[model samples]
Target: MTLIVTSSGRPCAFSEVVEKLAARRGEKLCLGEVVEAFGDRAFGPVMFFFALINMMPWPPGGTTLTGAPLLLLSMELAWGRDELWVPRWTERASVRRSTFRKLIGRFQRGLKLTERLSRPRLHFLTGSFGQGLIGIACVFLSIVLVLPVWGGNLLPAVAVGFFSLGVMQRDGLAVIAGWLLTAATVAVLFLAWRIIVASVSHGFDWIGRIA
Candidate 1:
């Protein structure tokens, strides 16, 4: 559920925002401060902020930290709210400066790569109605992302990243790509569940036959 930047020359790269946050003098960077720093571009940048947090292996409990905001953002966006808001406890969430630094290198690569390629095309997809659908999709993706499921977090995370990037940049193509990925992720999870269930049923049948 993370996203975008502007032509404001403020370094629209999500990684750059992480860099600035890391460069701050404080030992810990609060989630609220990150939200405020995003200004009018709050939706995309804020989502990306939490997404990057989720993407990283560091600072531990990364899923919980990022997932909560992702959920909040999804819900708020679904409601057509312009401003981003999280509960006081969620806002108070923080990450260490050193940890953010550790995440910068690889994380920046993926975000910058997409940023360079993505432009606002397929406008119809990012319109108000489209965004409401995206919010709902993101809500599902965020829930799956936080779950300790068999398919793991990577695919769902990538899907959410695309959704965030698409909405952030008003790039409809990217948003479509996100929906494609989201579908694939859900399919994979469902297949995995089916396999697990079949395997368990087979084991139970064998046990009964042997008994």
Candidate 2:
């Protein structure tokens, strides 16, 4: 396997990143250190990590914890910033190595499948302008993720995850898939909101009738 080393001397590929984390499975990890390890190419993988965390079936409040970082990263991307600048508070965030290792392990199979299908193509769609568009979509989705909408964060998280993968791999086709997923996410959320409103209105009418 071709190993592309980052400035921090860590492997740049997603699988290699996972392997590195696994090797340190019993140690403590800070978010900042992880970001630094990715060096100049921090945005894509870091954002992908946060997005993936939100996509997992973690405990309540996990989405908000992860989504905030995704929001910040997306904002930086949209602003055309060449380097990622995470907030000090966010940088200080820490997690157990075992937890991260388990998370990676759980998703490894799917990640491998995606890697097999991904290749650098449709270069225009993965350029700066396209990244900006993706950032905007991610911003919207991250907001949804942070909200207390029950069962509503999954689709957006998935969309962001796909976008992250596309960016990291320089695969424009994957980016296109992400955009399609984003569109579907929006439609699904709108329909769900409408249904909720209708249900609430019906409940109010029934209450009025009883009164």
Candidate 3:
């Protein structure tokens, strides 16, 4: 039901493949193959791509992302600007354009921050709340994807891919497994950050002593 049809109004899976491939390869692979080979589960791939896009860096002192082009970029990246048949959930269930705003609304319900986070949370972590959680990750990812930041898309992309695929296939164990993977990933990132900071601080201190 949440599956979006293509602009051409046919069942598309470009997005779905994007989600899956990103889970495994991030942006390293060829976009065209991903878009064309997605076969049936396009939403996943599209959502994954957006998740990565959402992490871009905008101007200084700005955390919000841009719009318009983000949607177009997603479409292009997922379906290729060529004549590829991209699938989108029909307009009946489609939620484009204001996707970021809608997600913030969902996250805000029980959350103190903006509600956008709620879409994915409700879709994957909790059902029966609003629309399916699949959109949560997709919309959130799309928000970050529109930004200008670097490396910002990785975590969210992976998270959304895992969550979306898990929910779509009804793989509850996979959901829990994803949580574990996420925790491990976070721990690794934190440790790496600490090491980098320590190394830099040590280097600066040594330089100062020598000077």
Clashes of 3: 44
Q: Which runs of model 2 end up more than 4 angstroms from their true locations?
A: 1-7, 25-28
User: TM-score, each model?
Assistant: 0.86, 0.89, 0.39
- Candidates sorted by TM-score, best first: 2, 1, 3
Give the winner by TM-score: 1 or 2: 2
Per-residue CA lDDT of candidate 3, range 69-142, in tens? 23443344333232334334221222232433344344334322211222233333434321143343334444
Ten contiguous residues minimizing lDDT sum, candidate 1: 1-10
Give the residue spans of candidate 1 off by over 4 A.
Answer: 1-13, 57-62
RMSD of 1: 3.5
Candidate 3, position 113, lDDT: 22
Instruction: Give residue 124's error in model 2 in angstroms.
Output: 1.5
Pick the TM-score winner. 2
Which 10 residues in a row give candidate 2 its minimum summed lDDT? 1-10
Cα lDDT tens digits for candidate 1, 1-211: 2334333435445666666777889888887778767765477667766766676643334475567778888888888998777777776888787887777766767767776888889999989999899889889888876665533566767777788887788899888888999999889989988999999999999999999
The residue ranges of model 3 lying beyond 4 angstroms of the native Cα positions read 1-45, 49-156
Instruction: State residue 32's C-alpha deviation in candidate 2, in Å.
Output: 0.9
Sorting all predicted structures by lDDT, with the top scorer first, yields: 2, 1, 3
lDDT of each: 0.75, 0.78, 0.42
Top-lDDT candidate index: 2
